[model samples]
Target: MKLTREEITAALVGLLGADSVIVEPVRMDPYLREPRKRFHQPAAAIALPHDVPALQALARWANEHRVPLIPQGGNTGLVGGQVPLGENEVVVSLVRLDKVRALNAEAGHMTLEAGVVLETAQSLAADAGALFPLYLASQGSARIGGVLSSNAGGVQVLAYGNARELCLGVEAVLADGRLYQGLGSLRKDNTGYDLKDLLIGAEGTLGFITAATLKLFPMPQGHETALCSVNSPEAALALFYDMRRRAAGTLTAFEIIPAFGLDIQLRHRMLDRDPTAGPSPWYCLLEISRPAGGPEGTLMAALEAAFESGGVDDAVIAESLEERARMWAFREQMSECQSREGASIKHDVSVPIAAVPELIARGSEAAVNLLPGIRPCPFGHMGDGNIHFNFSQPVDADPKAFMAGAEPIHAAIYEIVVGLGGSVSAEHGIGQLKTGLLASVKDPVALQMMAAIKAALDPHGILNPGKLLPPSP
Candidate 1:
């Protein structure tokens, strides 16, 4: 026997009070709509649990009834993970759980509630004379819970690391409503199977991340930012090696961008002025953080060496904070600028650091061959090997038609990426969008292990029902 929609709604209202549960269709729009505007299925209700106990009660009931629950934070996830996949599902928004539970700037750790905004966490760290380096374009709205759940990697991953590395522990509600109190500031804990790591990147399939203990760092005194022109990806790679040799640990960020990226940004009025030194085939936006007593001119000296080696053709080092911001603006605006051109197909993939040039070259050629005049805008964390391989539709092509024919293009790109010993997904987790893709690319034994873990933690299949894992055969 199953509960009807009205029964589900009334039960939720009873458990969490009428104010916390939303059953009206119009009022559910904000929680229902995801960033990509894909996956538009109606939810039975939107559950806004006011605290940890309320959330636990809701999860307990959902599990017992075998009702699916989708854990959402900020609704900024690019994939449809935060949105409902079926009408019977309930979206459990964690927005009201926002809080700063504890902060120890000197100890290099802070415990933050899942709903705390990423930007707010950064500010809290900065105010305490520390820095939270996990930055993203959507940081303003992307909450800590989803950030960790997705295991997000931002620009500075070259030095600091991704969300998984920055996090020390997590506090989550299991599928059966049992709280996993794993929060801590410990740098070493060899007790067991590392449950914190599992929940951090689990995509809410096993548990709901209610809060986390995140690692922080001492604020850098300043940053040396530059946008350098390179003849090719190979040249950029060589320069990257040289920069690493020179700066080593101080090298915080090294991003790559194509000329197509700049042209579109300027054409679409996304930037007030061009941020590059001059016209070039490609560009590398590199930055070095200076410590309290660190030497200056590190970036300039590295570039001079790169210029002598012909790895860098031209460069512009930021003489002021404004110039530095413009350089970063050029890098951060890469994804949004592509939309102005028209419909675009995007892949978040990664290869070995040394294989990135080959990945770009082969990927671009394959895309052009498939669709003539299709502009390839392959750019992103070049230092970390994750290239946001995006292709803008052919000029004057129908957006609908171009999008309809995306399967062949995706197949072409993924084939090349896998052939080069790369991953199909790098930073973005296997949300609803990539579950099938994950099944195809992932190792058979690995999939079995994941299934076993899911079965153990969520036997009723109530937690994020249709996400991360592919359908059972």
Candidate 2:
């Protein structure tokens, strides 16, 4: 039998102390609202456990009562996975678990509790003369657990991999309150099944991550930053090919942007100044990390070759550290600047690296055909083929109307993405936002296997119900 909201609160208070439970609505608002503001389900209560054992007890109680629990970190997730799905659920904030359990710079790994903020982890690695490569805009607010849960990919994913690649192992609380002590710092441990990978991107539908052993890298001497003006996405793709050919491993970031994005930023006064070479419809921001003893100007030498070959029309290399920051600010501020315009439709999708040009060209044309004057601002990690395909509303159009017609616009763009062999959701996981879309596009057998795994791990379905996976038949 299901329990009432009062019963759920009573049971949780019985397991943990009454002081640990938060039933009042106003105080629970922050934990309920996600970064996207797309999901608005009210949770029955907000549970804050001070330690691992307390968290385990709450999970066990939640499981016995078949009550859903949404595990959250710093609550910076783009998707709605970190927030509650329905009134029956409870949001379990892990902020109290913040602690650096162990750090081994020589071993190139560190064990951190789930609630350790991503920026803090980076600081820890830097203090130890090492580097943690998972950099994101929300790093200041996003915690390790949510980062690994989403398998977030920032601009540097071109050099270092996503959160899953950066993470070695995780210590989590499984359904029914059993602790999963799978944290390992070994280079290679081929033990039975790789539970770490499964849990990393499961988006909390699988288990509640408590701590993690994350992989670190040797600090680079510096970086070579440049803003290249390409005629179009085709030219940008060609430039990326040349950069990859010359600077194979050191090529860390290759981002693409449109002049419209810069215009919006400048109009909104988001950037100090324009960072591009001049006025062009498109630009490619490329960078390469110079090793401790490696020669500098490697990127400069390659850019010279591309310019000679007519692949790049114009380019500006950063002459100082401040200049490099300015160039990156132009790229990083793309998403926020869009909000200055109006309600924008957003899609984070990825295609084959080679098909990126076709994806952008075809997608932009289709969106325009659907909604004339729909400002297309498709930009992101070009090297990895993930484009944050977004569209600002037509000038003076009602925001509500624009959002109401977003579904057809989404269909048009997604049709092109699927035709070119692209993923519907990349970097961002399938939260409540994309459950229907995932069910439509994913393979039937793969879906079944996922359901089986989820059922096996969480037979009670008390872990983040109605989030990543679709409802069982």
Candidate 3:
């Protein structure tokens, strides 16, 4: 038998007390709203547990009643994992559990509760003379648990690795309320089955991440930033190889932005001033971080060599911190600026690093062929082979009608991405948005393995139901 909304609320209030529960539909708006605003289904209730014990109790209660629980932190997920699908599900928010449990800068580790905001964690590390190295656009609102659950990748991935690599250990509350205390700061643990890796990118399906021990890095003295003009994606690829040879581990970011991206941003007046070297068909935002007491001008020398060899046409190096901020603002604002243009079809897809040029070339050609007037805005972390392949609707076209025509555009781009040995959902995990697509594209045996794991860890199907893994074939 299914529980009514009133009965569910009563049970939740009894377990968590009335103060920690929000049953009013109007009051749950913030928790229901996600960053992308794609999935906006209502949840039955929002439960804010104040501590670990309360969280465990709520998990156990949900498990017993067969109630679906969506684990949310900061409500900043680009995918809809933190938001709800069915009105019967309850959102378990970890915001009240924010805390910095411990820190050891010399030993390069820090323990933080799930609800602690990413920006706060970075500031805490900076105060202790270390760097967290996980930089994301939504860091101000995104939290540790959600970041780990999503296994987020940002600009510094080339040097620092993604969220999964940055994390040393995790403490989670499983579906049946059993606490898994796997928080160890050790670098090497050959212990059987890496549960931490499994939970990190599980998207809150296997367990509710409560807290984590994160690896920290020595704070960089400063970053060398530059905006370079590339004649083609081929040239960008060649320049990347040369820079990698020179900068090595010091290379932090190598983002590629198309001329169309700049045009959109400029049309929307998103940037105070143009940050590129000049008007070029494409631009590559390159950066390299130098540790304290390390030599400077490594990035400049590499760029000089590339320019002499005709790998780059021109470049502008950041002479000050303000200039550096401007260079990054141009890259980070790529997504938001698109909104002002019109309805846009977007994909966060990735391919092998070496195949990036071919992927972009072929993907753009297919998109153009699909919709003749569609404006392609392909840009992002070229160093990681992840491109935010987005297309803006025709100028002055009806957004509703343009969106209605996006089906073929999406199909064309995704087909090209897959054909080039790429993933449909790269940085963004499969939430409600891509569940069906994941099932179709994922390997059959791998899908079965995921299903088995989900059943074993969350037998009741109570944790973030209908996320990450697809149903059996």
* Predicted structure with the largest lDDT when compared to the true one: 1
Candidate 2 local lDDT, 221-267, one digit each (tens): 99999999999999999999999999999999999999999899999
Could you tell me how far off, in angstroms, the CA of residue 382 lies in candidate 2 after the best superposition? 0.5
State how far residue 131 of model 3 sits from its true place (Å): 0.6
Per-model TM-score, in order, reads: 0.99, 0.98, 0.98
How many clashes does the backbone of model 3 have? 0
Q: Count clashes in each candidate, considering only residues at least 3 apart in sequence or on different chains.
A: 0, 0, 0
Q: CA lDDT, every prediction? A: 0.93, 0.91, 0.90
Worst 10 residues of 1 by lDDT: 32-41
On TM-score, the candidate that comes out on top is 1
Off by over 4 Å in 1: none
| CA shift of 424, model 3, Å | 1.2
119, model 1: CA deviation in Å?
0.1
TM-score between model 3 and native: 0.98
lDDT of 1 by residue, 79-186 (tens): 788899888889999999998999999999999999999999999999999999998999999999999999999999999999999999999999999999999889
Model 2 RMSD in Å is: 1.0
Residue 332: error of model 1 in Å?
1.0
CA error at residue 126 for candidate 2, angstroms: 0.3
